[model samples]
Target: MPNIVTLAEAKLFIRVLDDDEDTTIETMIAAATDAVCDVAQAWDGTGEPPARLKLAILSRVAIMFDTRNSLEPGIGEDRLLLPLRTVEL
Candidate 1:
């Protein structure tokens, strides 16, 4: 099965995407999706995503990662998004 995504991995991914504005949204979504997928795959050592939550958080993951205002509604004050809480120094 897939492996669980760690905080380090997530932070590193956010860093990598910080440099590429064009692909940030897609990359972040893929990273989050891969993270969940990784966890699912490793859960049973089956190397596959769990079929239980197929269309889970992966759907809105892109929107949460979309820092470029690519979406119309734009990032809101929802607690569902982590980026909204990150404080820059």
Candidate 2:
């Protein structure tokens, strides 16, 4: 599956330099994408993903990367889990 955000973009967001962790970063991106899709209840696996979704994914990836082995890596009050908007009739 194509990622909403590129590895380079994610790396830059997380302030990671060098290609040493490319594979790990890719995995993080995939996980983050899934998380965003799950929360948003959207994503057809094609087309440009929303900026908010991308930002949410990037934020998650950064948190995961920074707190790798911690027993409980806290993510407070995740705004990414906001309910999807609905059209009013």
Quote each prediction's TM-score: 0.30, 0.75
lDDT per residue for candidate 2 within 1-89, as digits (tens), equals: 56688999999999988999999989888877776676666555577776777788888788889988642322641554454332346
Give stretches of model 2 more than 4 Å off: 43-46, 70-77, 83-89
Instruction: Show pairs that collide, candidate 2.
Output: none
> What is candidate 1's CA lDDT for residue 76?
34
lDDT of 1: 0.40
lDDT of each: 0.40, 0.72
The candidate scoring highest on lDDT is 2
Q: Residue by residue across 1-89, what tens digits does model 1's lDDT show?
A: 23333333444544543445535444545555554443333234344434332333343343455444443222331323332133446
- Please tell me which predicted candidate would have the highest TM-score against the true structure: 2
User: Mind sharing the TM-score for model 1?
Assistant: 0.30
